[model samples]
Target chain A: MALDQSFVGRTYPPSRPYEVGREKIREFAEAIGDDNPAYRDAEAAKALGHPDVIAPPTFVFSVSYQEAESVVRDPKLGLDYARVVHRDQQFAYHRPVRAGDVLSVTSTIESIKSLAGNEVLDIRGEVQDAEGQPVVTVHTKLVARAVEAGGTGGAGEAAEGE
Target chain B: MTAQIAYADVEEGTQLPLRTFPVDRARLVRYAGASGDFNPIHWNERFAKEVGLPDVIAHGMFTMAEAARVITDWTGDPGALLEYGVRFTKPVVVPDDGKGAVIEVAAKVAKKLDDQARTVQVDLTVTSAGSKVLGMSRAVVALG
Candidate 1:
């Protein structure tokens, strides 16, 4: 089934503010095996001109992807949650996300297309600080594999050589 | 704010140092928890095979973050990163055994974008298990 074309350009409501904490940033940095002092030490970050420890660039993906759930799970969209695979990700930052910053994301459906029987959805997340200042923009592309004719509840067979 | 790297010192085609990051099942589990992307293909071998993956695979975002370290380490400032992007071309399949896959990343200055902002674009080549995992990976960063 094709995704709702009308959904394109629709912007969802801003998500609840998520307070960025030093510990969360530290945990994420550790998970990725990044030991950058600026990510874990306040003094290191302050020396780099940040108020406190800053998050790795990818840390914001957790918050942005969470905010995009509202779009992916929209009942009217008819998207198959199980068939989706992430394809591409991009981020443009106005500044590094720092601890103590309360952040919110507003997601907008940039485009929807179908290729090789796969449903492709493009979502752009606008991240902002507590004072509504722009922090970063996240662009995400999700590919929902077309359901097989006789298969149920699984992604379509992986495209050969993809 | 002063960037650790002085803009005058860098030139197009200057290569950043290569770095290799190891990814094991344990690391994937931690990444899954931290990123909130509990995709079974990253942690469940059976679920991964059922979903058409060879075996448990590391999260694409995790691979991307690992690649970014090349730039961050050179700049010495996470905030210096202005733009970053990548295309997930292949999965970094992680085995249950102790020896997990290693992602090797090599980067270089691709272009000098703005003199005033001291911005330069860096292109990265990332491989895991001897297969390219990310395509067109690049980062734009500001230097002093």
Candidate 2:
């Protein structure tokens, strides 16, 4: 089944505020093997004009994508999670996310399209600070593959085009 | 702190230094934990195979981060990164083998967007196993 076309332009409520922790930023940096001092040392970040340790540019994906769960899990959307694959991701930032800042996200369905038996859904996440100021806008595209004929759409079925 | 690269000195077609990042299973596990994305395909080989993936794969977000290093490392300022985007063209498959897989990232200054903002648009090519993994990868950054 294709995603509900009506869901397009629907905006979900803002998620609970998530505090950006220094340790979490450090852990994320380490996981990606990015030893940029600004990601670790407050002093280093301060030297770069940031108040504290700033997250790597991609760190916001953790928060923004999690917020997209509301859309992905929407029963009305009829998305088959098992057959879904990440298609594209883009982030436009107002500033680098800094440690100790609290952020919230409001996810909105940007578009829903069907192409070649695949459902392409785009969700835009608006991340804001405690002051209600925009921090970053994250755009994500997910493609749900169509189930094969006479097949149960069970596990081990690869999506076409890899 | 690494010295910030001045915007005035950068020219179109300037290539950023290349960097290679190794993606082993252990790193994927840590990334999953930190990102709160417990997608089994990124960690469990059985689940990945069940999903028709070759083996355990690195998270697409993880691959994006690794590729951004070229820009960040060049500017020496994370905050300088203003915009970034990528299309997941292929998976960075990580086998159980100790060597895992390596992502090679090469980037260049494709264009200069704004002189007043000192912003330059960067184009990136990210590859794994000699195959492109991220397509249309680009970044906009503020320079000194």
**Consecutive 10-residue window with the lowest summed lDDT within model 1 chain A:** A153-162
Off by over 4 Å in 1: A150-162
**Residues A43-140 of candidate 2: C-alpha lDDT, one tens digit per residue:** 99999888899999999988887789778988877798777778889999998899998999999999999988888899999999999999999999
Model 2 ranges with Cα > 4 A deviation? A150-162, B1-3
lDDT against true structure, model 1: 0.88
Highest lDDT model number? 1
Question: Interface RMSD values for the candidates, listed in order?
Answer: 3.6, 3.4
Interface root-mean-square deviation of model 1 in angstroms is 3.6
Candidates, DockQ: 0.56, 0.59
- Write model 1 residue lDDT over A41-75, tens digit each, in one string: 99989998999999999999999999777789898
| Candidate 1 local lDDT, B20-92, one digit each (tens) | 9999999999999988888777888888777666788888899999999999989998899999999888888
Report lDDT (Cα) of residue A88, candidate 1: 82
DockQ-based class of model 1: medium
